[model samples]
Target: MSGGLIGLSGLIILFVLLIIRIPVAFAMFAVGFAGIWVLRDLNSAMSLLASESFTIASSAELVVVPLFILMGNVASVTGMSARLYDAAYAIVGQIRGGLALATVLGCAGFAALSGSSVASALTMGKVSMDQMNRFDYDNRLSTGVVAAGGTLGILIPPSTGFVIYAILTQQSIGRLFLAGILPGLLLLSMFMLTVVLLCWLMPGFGPRGPKSTMREKGRKMAGALPVLLVVILTIGGIYGGLFSPVEASAVGAGLVILIGVLEGRLGFARFWEAAKSSIVTSATVMLILISAHLINPFLALTHIPTLIGEYLSALDVAPMVVLGLILLTYLVLGCFLEGFAMLVLTMPIFFPVITQLGMDPIWFGVLVVLTLEMGLISPPVGVNVFVVKSVATDVPLGRIFAGVMPFWIAMLVTLAILVAFPQIALILPNTMIE
Candidate 1:
């Protein structure tokens, strides 16, 4: 069979497996192994699989993922999230829809340390939900904001998604991390604006409260300063080139533990729980990586990427049109599949089209991360919505989905801006890397 035909067959089998409810990693590995055997040979394919698994697992750069995850877990265990919310609420909790806005801001801060959207949503949900309910904030808006805001975890510095993208595209991890900063902040600003505007336009949806006393505000700020310092020292160290990404993660994890210990938050039992959780999460990610290893090589052996690259170049369509089609594909697939699975399934095919259009890899990485953020909040399979819904049993899935629509639109507009002016995503990396 022709290599291109083999590639097409493999893709069809993959989608079939997914639709049948097969585990994504397993489905990819199974199809990838069979495709490799047909396209190459059994022995060569096994050898390739074994080597790729080790190479990916032992990559020094990949250490950043586990360490960053550990930092997040440690902070959660040590009660950093409450301090963050206290500060956020003191600043924004008096206005109409203020509690909802505080939830967004607090989630963004917590997300910086906790790179998982589910974790940020759950943690901030515990901290802010009651206060929002007390403040008469609409349930749909209150829950939706945290769920949507938590997605900033994947776009901010130290994001696992960015790390995976950097590895897949062979882009500089540091540059990808740098590239996400503005977009992340831009998204945060837009979300806050949405909250304010929504409250202004429909005052019945949100009611204002008396402002916090000066003493209360001062105490909240004081308690939150430690978290700010930790974030500044760790992220600043990386962007400043004082430490590599891996080293920055280590330092961040260590500092979280150090703070926990000094504050008496790191008891023996708590430390063990934190360590075990981190191990479990890290192991889960590694297993997925190992499974994806089998698939990536098989795709290469089938000459799929090159064939698609050639086909895309042959098309007379404008590059921007092709890019729109790819983005639309992500939006459609996102409604049913998790972001990681989506990345594994599509990267082999769409990445070729992207490179064929001569887009900057770093910019493209940010754009992809933003798309995944959308997937986390969109309905049916929206992971963050599920997480929030799990905690708030009264909030129907439909309302949570309804509430996220504005943020989704905001994300689309932000994407359009980045697409029109690549500099939004690329300028920092270009100037800073030199």
Candidate 2:
């Protein structure tokens, strides 16, 4: 039997394991180990495992992942989300569906610090939903905006997804990060625009309140200035080459702690909690990554990625058609899998095909991140949706899902734009690095 077919059988076993509710990391690892043993020998497989683990563990770039995650955990536990939301509300709260708009904006701002979508959604929903409900905003609209907006966590800088993609594809983490900035802001704009449009069309969807005086607006802006500065200093330093991503994360974490202490918001208890959470989260990510390395070499031995790339390249297909299909597949797979697991599993198979077809890796990363956003809000296992439901249990899951539909449409529209004009995701990275 051919090596590829032997590898193909491993894939089948992996899927069966997944369907039986095996953890994704261990399932992939087991299948990969078995595949290597079958194709070569147990000794070679054991050597590969030993060597790959050391290499992945020793990489300098990998430090950025845990550091950034630690920064996020610190910012989250220090009550940064509430402060950002208050600042957002002060700016937009008086407008039609203002609180909803604020929720989206707040999520985007919070996302700058927190790289996890589930964390962002959970934090923002807990802090923002009651205010939205108080404003008499539609349940679906409020829930939808927050859930969709939480996805920006990865779309913006310091994302675990971007780090993983860079590592997997051997791309520069800094460039991958720069590539996402404009697209992230662009999506943020589109999200805000969608809220406005919805309010304009269906006035009852979001009710307008008394406009704030200039003085009040100024105070709100000032209240949020510290966070804005943190974002600018950390993200700005990384993009501007003043600090490496890892150093930038350290700076960010320090700044968050400083701000929290100055404001008397981050006591020892909160700091300890954040530290413990960061350690646990970092351990989990490292485990998944180790598992990915195991599966990756096995998949490479199959040369299936090459075969898939050749098949895709040979097809009489428009790149956009293929792009759409890939996205639709993500949308479907999203219903069952969380974003991180899905990316780790599929990128090995799909990214090569897309890259060989002359697609930009940076653009593809944004597209993948955007597509993963849907998975966060999609039914069954939508991480963000489940988060919102957990916080607002009185609200039905159906209503939260229903509310998120418009935002989902907004996300789809943004995806179409990125696909149509690859420049949207590429221009910043290209020029910035030059």
Report the number of clashing residue pairs per model.
0, 1
Task: Name the best candidate (by TM-score).
Answer: 1
Candidate 1 lDDT, 107-202, residue by residue in tens: 888878867777788888888878877877788788888788889899888788988887776778889889999999899988998888888988
Give the whole-model CA lDDT for all candidates, comma-separated.
Answer: 0.84, 0.84
Q: If candidate 2 were superposed on the true structure by all CA atoms, what would the RMSD be?
A: 2.0
Candidate 2: stretches off by over 4 Å: none
Which pairs in model 2 have colliding backbones?
140-403
Give the Å shift of residue 159 in candidate 2. 1.5
Candidate 1: stretches off by over 4 Å? 1-6
| Predicted structure 1: lDDT | 0.84
lDDT of 2 by residue, 1-434 (tens): 99888888888888788778787778878988888888889998899889888988898888877667767777778767787888888888888989988888888888888777777888898899898788788888888887888899888887888988888888888888888888888889988998999999999989986688888888878877888899999999988889988788889888888898999988999989988988888777877888888887888899886687677777898887887878888999988876777888788778877877788888898899888887888888777887888888888999989888888888888888888898988888889887
